[model samples]
Target: MSILETTASILKLMVERQGAIRISDVIHHLGMPKSTASRVMSQLESYGYLEKDEIHGTFLPGPLIMSASHLVNRQLTLNDHVDAALRSLCERTGYTGYISMLDNQEILVLRVIHGRQSLPVVTWPGSRSPAWGTSTGRALLARFTDTQLHDFFASPQVVSQLTGSQQDVSMLVATVARTRDAGYATAVNESVADTASVSCAVGDPATHDAVAFCLSFPQQLATPEELQRIATLLKEAALTIAGKTGDTQVSSPL
Candidate 1:
């Protein structure tokens, strides 16, 4: 292959794996001369397309590549819609609002909107929590099929590392069922001690990916009335999101 083709292939590998790539691995995979591969890697690093670990002698995607990836992902996903909804929810409730979705067995926060409160609950994009312990997690999990749920709980090692009190598989199954029936989910001092959250799933079950919108507050501060209001507002916001996405199955709460 030409030098340009070789460089492109190497960069593709780095982007796809999202981890460090060793020079030897690149050489073995690409069948390029050591000298040519080193030259290409050095040039790419100089331009900030790749970063090298001095200690491990491995190369990883650099700031420029990651930024490009982020831009592409933001454009491809429902990031803008979810971000706008979270902001509006935060404004309406004066509590921290966030969008989270299941990532494997964990809940990954995609966006967060800090409330106007002086001591708002702090959360950041890309943060992860236990799937079985957070309101958002449960809300999205409620959409999983029985077989999918069984497969998720089949791995004890995965379940053991989850953040809250250890729960039985039967208990988790029951929780999912309840969440499905309730049209929303609640977690009080579960994922994080002293924190309370309520969430509802967004988008159509068949068309779009499982996602949830959540609002969180101090456990001691969340009153029954406040919780109910938040749940109602979350459902409304979720419906709006589903509508915007052209999901016709808007009859379901989740």
Candidate 2:
């Protein structure tokens, strides 16, 4: 990797670990000469991307990191709105709720709410779930171009469920097609056993990225009629969230 890329990789590692890393550690991770790593570290330090604690002799994220992240998280209000929306959805529906957005190749859970009655499902905040295997992921996948969809299907991350309900790209694509036609997506025990969810995309008002609001319930509790009503609520809530959040794209779900 180029020096710049290497520096960025190092920065990402440190941020993920949330721990101080020494110069020797950086060299060991990168498998580069000490002199090269030292040069890269010096440049990063000069650029205010990293700071070394003199006493510990280890580097940590510098002020610039927080400033840049603040600008990003500030723009989406991702953290702020996610928790509020999740809580409101769970309260309204009496089911677990979550909001997710496509982050790179993964669907990232921004917030989650567990309702009063405990369900068998296991989920958490800031969790990363596969976009190819869940209803929320399929909601976004339906909107991708043919080439993008093909590329995503080719990736190894996509997996077939043991439930024997749906398998292969054709079936998944067909499901997305139906979701696009219906203006929402639903999966019954697709991700977790005995748990189902319905989701609708939260279109960005500005850049038009596909975001989603999801409601999850026990398989027995989520009847067809209930799902139909929940679908309406989810659609309306997603649009409301987008409008209130100043999302850029005004396009409704298809």
lDDT of 1 by residue, 142-194 (tens): 87788888888776745677436557779888998888777789988776777
Off by over 4 Å in 1: 1-77, 118-121, 162-165, 204-208, 248-250
Per-residue CA lDDT of model 2 for 78-185, tens digit only, reads 445555666787897788887777776678887677777567876776788778778888777767777888877776555432135446668777887787677678
Predicted structure 1, TM vs. truth: 0.63
**Can you give the TM-score per candidate against the true fold?**
0.63, 0.60
Give the poorly placed runs of model 2, Cα more than 4 Å off.
1-79, 159-166, 205-210, 244-254
For every model shown, the clashing-pair count is 0, 7
